[model samples]
Structures are given as structure tokens and as C-alpha cells.
Target: MAKKADKYFKEDKWKIIEEGFNPDYGMVSESIFSLANEYMGVRGYFEEGYSGNKLIGSYFNGIYERSEPDYNHYKGVADFTEYMVNSVDWLYTRIEIDNEQLDLYKSDFEKFYRELDMKTGILTREFVWKTAKGKRIAIKFERCLSMTEVERSTWQASIKALNFNGKIYVTTGLDFSNIHRNSGENMWNCGEKFIQADKNITLGIEGTTINTGLKVSSNCKIQADYESMEEIIEDKLVAVKLCINLEKNKEQKITKIIRNLTLKDESQKEEYEDKKAKIKDGRDDVIVLNEELKEESRKWWENVWKRSDITIDNDIENQQGIRFCIFQMYQTYNGAVKGTNIGAKGLTGEAYNGNAFWDTETYCLPFYLFNDREGAKNLLYFRYKTLDEARKRAEVLDCEGAFYPIATISGKECCNLWQHASLQLQASTAVAYGIWFYEKMYNDKAFIKNYGLEMLIEISRMLATRGDFDKDGKYGYYCVMGPDEFQMMVHNNCYTNYMGRFTLKYTIEKVKEMKEKYPKEYEKVVKKINFKESEMNKWKQIIKNMIIPYSDDTLIFEQHDGFFKLPHVDIDSIPISDFPLYNHWSYDRIYRNDMIKQPDVLMFMLLFNSDFTKEQLKANYEFYEPRCIHESSLSPSVHSILANQLGKEEEAYDFFGFATRMDLDNYNRNTNEGIHTTSIAAAWMNIVYGFGGLRSDGEILSLSPTIPKNWDGYSFKLTYNDEILEVKVNKEEVTIKTLGNKLIEIKVFDKVELINDEGYTYKFT
Candidate 1:
């Protein structure tokens, strides 16, 4: 890897080389990786730097966001940005000795190593850093993104004394000044210190009706301590803390135990000594029991590896590339719905504060459904819990049915861009598809009869309300947009039209099943939804006649009617910096270009896989891949899967790499905000579904193996149709391992199912 100066810009150019570490930087020197049932990920950093950039980060699900605004609020209930969390930024604190900022680039340091034991989820950072005056110190810090009490955050630091030095002081800083931007853009300039660090580790921060206030009036349990010192800076001695004597470090460790800060509301303080004594009670017992917190983290990861590990070809660079992508995503996942997943900015920087993209439905969902059914259900439940608020959103516009947000942190609409928000309502259809995805994988019938069926009913009702009928009785979801931010105020978009029809079909089926199985429940649900039987008839008519303007002869699915009539400009040779054209061009201009933010035709094809034939998949893949600008970090992964299905091997791998590297290498160059947590699950899907050739037919497991020329072998485990099946692939054939020794019938594509022994294998196509 290329070396950097005082500034640490990850030179992701070379992939095979190992990078060194620097620890003077507290959390700075730490490398982290995180996983939840939702997703897995990691991160690396130089620990000794005081001046190297602030920190490195990674995150995974249910990584939250209130990303952008839904501008067309004048129409439906919500847009986006409403359902998000100003998530706690785990990356923190730089100690400035005297006037010199604590920077690895600015100081002399040694003995730095950041090790991530993949077997366990323990990340340990160790190093010694010296001040400009030659005061040396040794330190070790450990951290883990929780896998146990899902959604909780935890970390611990252990500092050691190295030498007899001067008076030492340390001040934990919690900056909470950024969270207000009303520029019709979600500019995450405000830090919004949400963690409570008052007396103990308690803080509250949010961009509410105020200037992005952080009211840290609450906490779980935390303790901290520090002493102040007078240090000379710029030829003047001032009382401040950021440095201390080796003697003081030793004294605190020996003589009197260091005081622990108790947390509380801004008005409260912790009773440290008393609590410390209480905390120490079982310490001896814990020491004897041999706590395996670190070991358990490893074991958990070992299980993940057994299920999800991938082996790339000798191109260690690409191997590193894929790992790096997974790393960033794993960290940012705040397991609670109270927290929205991070955006592409992945806590490395604050970009979109609270925006949920279609990535959640189309990209991130598959990964979660396959491995952690409950986690995926939690995400669905999140939307369900917000159903009331979603309804309120519709009422605000005098509309019926719950209209979910486009981008949000509070499960409320936040995005104010009309085209952006209305275009995303289409995601609700995908959300329905996600419900179906869960059912196919887990067969959790009770879950569906209760939450799933109801959710589908409401969403279908929402789509019905959102649509219009032409004189010929064909349904037209008019004046709306598709994933392509271009083409505003257009007629029925093929993707949108198909999605609506799909929603109607699924909702009716679910309602019908409920009616037969639980007549009372179905009647109660229908009554509660205020759904008229006439509405069902309307939906059927719409599904039967909805216009999808695709040209088979031209081999193209028009994004919407009159789409080709608009000016067409391909991004054949655009500069990297120019890739984010929204900064320069007007939204109108952007809409006019052939550029698309994410998959539209590909999305339809992926969701309704059985609807499109092999030739259709090939045709759409070829037509849309070139035209796709992939502005959304959520795009590449879906494209990769479709490409894989269509036998476009090279495009699949390249797009997969692009998706995986989106935030880690900061390929989008926007990691300054928070990472794109939800979007990255797409990268995982690209590996499992695209490379491993994993798919579903709602009733059976399907596999079509096509290893990248660069991969040695790749394998992934899935709980398919309630059967835990392992799919392994080399250069040609694919193998599956399952329990019970049943002859499993699998499909090469969605069309053919092959019966293989307990361990199934199929040659590459």
C-alpha cells in the first residue's frame, strides 16, 4: 500500500501489501469490525497519529439513516429523512499535549499494532506514543460491536504507566454542535452529540425542532475519570488536560484507584467511588470464571465465517478489497430501530444524517433474510411499528392508507425533494417483496398471518390510493417517478407499474389465505383497514391493464412513457470527481440525462424473477447496465446479481467490487459523514447471490455457480426453506451441504431443480 503523510488517506491502490499501525491516537490506532444477525463488517486505522484525520469506521445492520428529503410531500404522505437516527459516532477523541495536537504525523511514536482476531470479534489496539517533549506512554484499547444483547454498544480501554513523568491530565471531549441544515439538503454538518457523557456515559442528541440539540439526559451505565494539569503552550502555561505524567499514571493505578465518572442528565453527576466499589464486588469471581468476552466474539465470527466466508483468487488485493468493504458495514449497524442505519458516509464523516434508501428493500434485505430471520423481521417490524405514523403522514395530505417515508430517522418522512420522495414510494412494493422473501426462507407462517399479511394489505391499499384509473380502466400511477431520479411527473413507469401490480397480487393472495385460515382475523383486518371489496376489484383491473412501456424489439424497458423522447447522454468517459454530478447540475438537468441512481428494470426482474425469461433477463441486463450511473451506493450489488443471473461474469465481479469498496476506500469520497450501512448489505448479497449464485423461487432453493476468474472458491450458508444448506463453488461446479441426508432438489436457474445428495454439487454453466 502507498504511504501517507500527517494525513492518513487510505491508499487502496495496492491490495496485497500489509499496512502498519500507530497508537498514540487512543481510538485512532484501533481497527474495528462489527456484525449483527443483520450484516458483518471491519475497519483499520493508524493509532499513533494526533493529526491524521479524525478516525476510521465500519458498520452494518440495522444500520439506520434519515438520508435525504422527499420533495413531493404535496402529493403522498411522506418522503424520506423522517425515519432515521442521529446514531452515536463510536469514533472519538484526540488528546492534544501542550499546544501540539495529538497527531501521529506530528509526534514521535513506536510499538503500534492493531489486530482483529477474526475467529473472535475482539479488536485490540496497542502502541506507545510520545509528546514533542519526549514523554512516552503505553496503552491498549479493546472494542467490539455487540453480537449478544443485539443493538447495545460497548467498549473498554486499559491504560498503563510507562515512566515517572510530569503532572498528567486527560479530558474526554464530546462535541455536539452539528445537526441543522434547512437547505432542502441533508447536510450533516452538525455533530449532534447523542451519547450521554455527562457524569457517567450518558448523552442525548437529535436534530429536532431545535438547532440539532443533543440533550444527553439519559444513559445505561458508564464511568470515567481524569485529572487536570498546567501545561506550557506557545510559551505560556495554561491549565488544561490532554497529557499527564507517567508517575501519575502509575500513582492512579497503585495508591488510590482512579475515580470513575457517573453519568446522568446534564444537571446530574455520578457517585463514582461508591459505584466503583459495587462494580468491584464480583470482579474476583469474574476473574476466576475466565470470562471469554473476547473469545465469544471470536466464536461468533467463526460461525459467520463458516456460513459466509469467501475466498478470492490469488489476487489478495481483491480479497482485501472485499474484506475492506465488509468491515465498514459491520461497524455502523446500531441494532435498534430507534437508530436508522448509517449512510455511505459510515461515521467516518457525517453526510446524510437520516435517510433510508431503497437499498433496505432491494439490496440489504436478502442477506438478512437468509441468515438472521429475526433481525430481518425486526427491520420489517420497524416499518410496521411506524405504520400509524405512516398513516398520519397520509392524513396530512388528505389521503388514505399509510404512506411510508422516502428518507427518515423517526419512521417519518424527512426528504423534501418531491421527485426523490414520490419516486421512492415504490420501495414499499419491494418491502412487500421482502416479506415474501422472509416467508420463502423461513416458513414462519404465524409471523405472516399476523404482521406480514396486515402489512401487505395496508401497502397494497396505499398503492391503490396512490394510483389513478384512465378512461379505458387501466391503472396509471401518474405524476410519479421511478428509482431513476430522472423523468419527473411522468406517467406509469414500467418498474413502478409492475411493482404496483405485484403488490396488488401479493396483497390479495395474503388476504385470501387469511380469509380461509383465519376468517375472523381476515374480517377484522379488512374492517380495520377500511378496505372496501370494490377496492380489490379495482386493483385487479389495474393489475390486468397497467401499461408497462418496454420495447422488446428495441430491447429496452422505457423508464416511463416518453422517456426515450427526452435527451439521452451516456456517461461514457466522465471524470471521477464529476461522478457526483448533483453538486454541479440542477436536479432538472440530472433528470434529463440517461443517468439512473439505482436499478429499475433490474429491480423488477430480480423481484419478479419468474415473470421474466432467461432472454429477457439477458436483454434487460445488457440494456440497463451501460445506462446505469449507479449514483446510489445501493445500485452496484443488485446489478451484480442480475448480471450474474444473465451470465455477465465480468460485469458482475466488477460491480460487486465497486459496491464492496463504496465506503471503506471512500471510493465515493464522502465518508466524512457516516458510512452507508444499509447499502453495503448489497455488497454482501453481491458475493452470496451473484458469485455464489443463490436465489429463491418462493418454494425452493436455487443455485447457479459462476466463480470470478479471480476467486479460488466461494461458499455461503443459507437457511433455505427452513433447511440450512451450504452452497460451495470452485471454478466450475457448485456444491451444497445440508442436514438429514435428504435428497435436496435445487435449481441451476429458477427453471431447473436438480436432486443432489446430502452434499449437492452442480457444474458451472
Candidate 2:
């Protein structure tokens, strides 16, 4: 056995590099170096297009198209809905010299390098190539999506002739041929295109889906120093050509300014304007747009890094990995818009079909809440806006309350699996938990009165309908799925039951508060939803008798009904190649036997740490971790956080390493499809919640910092309750400082210290 080398471009506190070209790893690198601005994302494929294996993707957060055969089942159990469709390909460039096209694969090329500058949210590539006809040229390119403008991006390419003085031709365009790579059906239909040629070239194309009927438009204008001409070639491809005569060692540069707009951006149907007119308006401002966007994007990233940056002092690999995870997570979604949640693959690639999942509430929301509270509020607002759809889904399932979909684009359940999509039920609880988590830290009563209380009440109502009293008079849920997808149709899943109990209890409290504080709002909600006043008694009854499975002998909670009765084979017994049993064995075989894909019971215990004792946590973690295959990228961070809490530092670091490198090292061997967007946020959790031991209990923020053995120290900033605080831990002492002018109290290793408006630092000895 041999250890694999860590893959990255370079070791910097602030930059991500793909040091040299790895054509074999081209697609993976594209995912790693992907760029986004919370609105749109583009993968890092070559600008001078390659015929090699790659997914040329550009995505908008809410622009999607529908597909048929969503589920493999025979019954009409699934809904016909749109998944996030891959948008236009805006990075097409064809370079030719002396009648030969410049293909990196076929040419003599060297000094190939690519970098994603985190500081400015820009991606750059540089290389030198010798054409087959013996003409040598050097090329450098830079690209960025604007964070300030939110709808604009720029790509600039500079070409220099080193040895030959001859004619050079370049073709650049907004391409729709490679819009989607789906196998089943066309996700987008070509609609209309408009082009104009002058000193600069302007092109616009719009498409509507056959199923969803949502319209999306992308427009671009090219600016260059050479003579350029524009044309519409294939009804789908809009191209601009540049011709130049270059002298020895002379350089020529071309830049494209692009703007993307979709109907999703419109607040109302009548507000939607003509796509052609919008395209023309964008081109009219092309002179100063690129430079202005560049500066604004830089400033936005600067503020983001100031508030969210985490610095690991000694380990460069893990340091870079941690930052890369944070960078990508922020790039994917900033919680900018209401009614839009992050996808499993984000905007980077089309994997998971760009449907929102429970991962957004459970794994990704905390990151945004801690750094960008308004963004976090917007994410929850998405769920709030979709509440009516969830209620309708609950009716279809014959459940009493809203049944949040397992995966969705427009609030409809797109996943076909009955157990996963319909019965996982904990997803509803997760949304409730997110609300509670936010309210506990911020205590925004207006939010609860206006939005949060209604959601909690509906979810709690669902739980009351979903569960029943058993023969032993214990209320419990049956035939459900937990976080561990390997197990299905199980009874009394502890995670689901406990979270249901928590939601019911929390909802009761919030309703009482709402009635006392805002009687008018409470009455309005009651009238709007037809919520029964007597449902309170049902919620209390269910909460009082919720049966959570546990084992007296093992001192650990059971994952579900009869889980221990199965023949258990520890993961160590399986061959390394035979691991991730889902890939190697039949579903029935893996299902009947005991092999945990991730920590189901342990995850519940970790999230609700105060409920369980340390000894109990250790017992359950020890029992389940060895059996965990960690097939889900979401697995390792949970294990890592629990390990750190249980004082198993060695195990904690190992699991942290696994999570931090999940995408960077392609540990799951699936990075080619897309980076695991949720897991990236989980990696950040491993550092802050795991190593930093940060916890909030509705009153005070607390930390029990434990420095990793290999590191000198680590520091991170968090925005808590509208105040910024920094926590830095070294071998000997822990220091907490408030960066804002607000009085705050935080418990350090169980000791409370007050930081005042004067801004003070508290040191623990």
C-alpha cells in the first residue's frame, strides 16, 4: 500500500492553484476551479475549446428546465417538474494561426498553468504552444463573474506571437450547442436570437423549456483591438471573429463582456421586459463595465474574506483545503434570493440535477448564518414561500401536515423513491430546526410572528399525523428513512422521532409566544392555514410519549427498529475494493445486512449534544464509527465533529482530513461529476464546530478550543447576533475578542465572560 500525493496548485493562505495541466484530470480540475457569484457559475474548461472529456457548464441559480421519466417506478408516484438546467456555454474560443487550429492536445505546448484567485473571485490560465505549422504563440487568459453587478462576467484573452509574423484568427461566441449533456431528452429548446455588428459585436439568445415554459436569456458583446466581425451561424451559435496581422513579439488582447438575465429575476409576470431590449441595454454600457465590475467584485470578496476567513498555522494542505471548501460554498450560494436554495452540486455541474435537498438546511445553512445572517434569512424565506406547495404535497401523501420534498427545484418533489422522498420526514424537522437555530441566536421576534411560527406549526402538525401510539402506548413513527440511506422502511428511527419531538415542543412554545406578543398575527395565521386550536393537545401528547429507540446493553441509541437483529459485519472485514457496498453489492443484500453508510444515530446525538452525556456519546460513537463506510461526503464531518467532542483527537483529525480532502483528492472518485457542495460546508464545520468547539444554546456563544496536535494555532471570525467576534486558540491559552461595538456574553469552557461596547478581549488561563 502507498499513500497518494496531495493534489493542488500551490500552498498559499489565500489562493487555489492547479500548478500544471493534468489533461487526464481535466474535468476534476474544472469542478475544483469552478467560479460563481451567487447568481451564476461556470466550470473551468479551456477557453480555446477542447474535444477531450469535460462537462462544459454554466448555471443560473433558479433557471431550470423539465425532464420526463423522473423516477424509474411504474406508478404515477412522481411529479413532472423541472430540474436545474445547464445554461449557455459562454467560454468558447477558437484560435488559429497559419491555417492551423490551436489545439492543446495536438500541439506542442508547455508552461500550462491555471489558478482561481480567491481574493478577487477570478480564474486565470497561461500557456505557450507551437502550432503544427511551426508558429509559436503565448496565451494568457483571465475570467470572473461579478459579485457586485450580480449579472455580469468578463473574459479576457491575450495572445502574443513569439517567432512568426503572420495572420491570426480568433472566433469567440455564446454557444448553445453544448448547453446540456443529458442522455434522455433535450432540456432546453432554441427560441430566438438577435445579433448586431459595429465597432463591437453584440449577440443575444433566449430559450424556453418544453415542460416548464421558463424563459432564460444570455447576451454578450466582444471588445478587441483587432478587426472583428459578427455572424449567426447555426441558428444556435452566435459567433464573433477577429482577424489580426501580428509582428514578432507583438501582443493582441480581446475581451468579452457578458450579461445573463432570466425570468426568475422578475418579481412579477408583468415586470418581465423584452429580452432583446435588455440585451441591447447591456451592450450599450460595454465601455467601462468590465473594469468597474472587476473592482466591485474584488471589494465584495475582500469583505467576505475579512469576516469568514479561517487560518490554519502549520498544515498547508489542510489549510488550503479548508479555504477551498469555504470559498466554493460561498461561491455556490450566498443566500441572496428568496425561493432559491442551494443544489447538491451547486451551480458548478448538473449532478443531482440541481435540486435542493435537506443538506441545505442541515449542513450548509449554519455557514451562511454565522457569516451572512441576511443571506441565511433569505434561504429560510425560500422554504417559507414554498409552504403552500408543501401543504399540497402533504395532501397527496394523505399526511396531516406539509411533507417537504426530498429534492426539488420549484417546491415539487422530484425524487421518486417513496421512502426517501416521502417518508424521510426528518427533512421537515430539519427546516424547523433551522428556524429555531436562527431565532435562538438572533431572537428576531418579528420573523417568528410573521414567518417562522407558521412553518413550525405546519411541520409539527405533519409529525403528529405521521406518527401513532404503539401497543405499549408509546408514540412512534414507522416506515421511514433516516440520514443513513442504506436503511429504509424502518420503524421508530431515533433521529426522526427525536427531531419530531423537538419540533413539536418548540412549536408549542413559539405559538404561545406568538399569541401573547402578536395576537393579530397569530389570528391571521390561524385563519390562513385553518390550523386547529385543538392540535396543541395532539402535539403535547406526541411529544410526551415519543418512543426513541435505544439499547440498554450497548448503551447506544438504535438506528431504527430491529437494526441490531441483523447480521453485522464490521467495515474492516470487507476488502478495500469491496467497500462502499452500494457500488459493489446488490441493494437487497446490502439492505438486509448491517452496514451503516453514515452516522445516523450519532448525527442526532451530535446536533443535540446537551441531551446526551459524554459517556453515552463515546459509547455510541465507538459502536457506529467503525461500521461507517462514509459513502456520503456528509458522513466524515459528522464523525469528525463527534470524535472531537468525545475527546478522540486522533480520530477527529483523521476524519477531518478525509472530509477536507474529499473533493481536493477526489477521495470518492466522483469529483468529475461535480464537487460535493454540502460537504464543502461540512468541512468548514469540522474546523469551527469540531476543532473550535463552537456551540450556541440560545443565550451565549461558547468555545472549548482544542488545538490540533500538528498545528501551532488557528483563528477564525464569526458574526454572532449582529456582532463580529474572533476566536484564536494556541497551545496554552484561548482568546476571544469582540470586533464590534456591542455588549456580549460568551462562555469559555463553561465560564461566562462579558465583552462590552468598548471592545474587550477575554483570555482564559
Per-candidate clashes come to 111, 2
- The runs of at least 3 residues in candidate 1 whose Cα sits more than 4 Å from the true structure, single-residue gaps closed, are 1-106, 115-118, 150-292, 323-349, 573-577, 739-744, 749-757
TM-score for all models, in order of appearance: 0.77, 0.96
Candidate 1 residue-wise lDDT at 459: 80
lDDT of each: 0.56, 0.81
RMSD of each: 7.3, 2.3
The candidate 2 region of ten consecutive residues with least summed lDDT is 1-10
User: Residues 1-765, candidate 2, lDDT per residue (tens digit)?
Assistant: 111334645667677777667778888888888998778888888878887787888888888876666445544256565577876788789988777887766778888888877888888899888777777788999998887666789989988999988778999887766647664445667777767777677877776656677766777888887754646566566777778777789888888888777776345445445545756755244334667778888888899888999988888888788888888878888865556788899888888888889878888988988998877888888888889878888878778778788888888888876767877886788899899988987888888988898898888888888889988779998888898888888999889998999999999998888888899999999998888879999788888899988877778898888988978876666777775566789877767767888779988787777778888998998888877877788988898888998889998988787677678787777787888999999988899999999876435778788988999989988898688888888877767777877877887787787875454344545
- lDDT for residue 95 in candidate 1, whole number 0-100: 51
Model 2 scores what on Cα lDDT? 0.81
Error of 2 at 695 (Å): 1.2
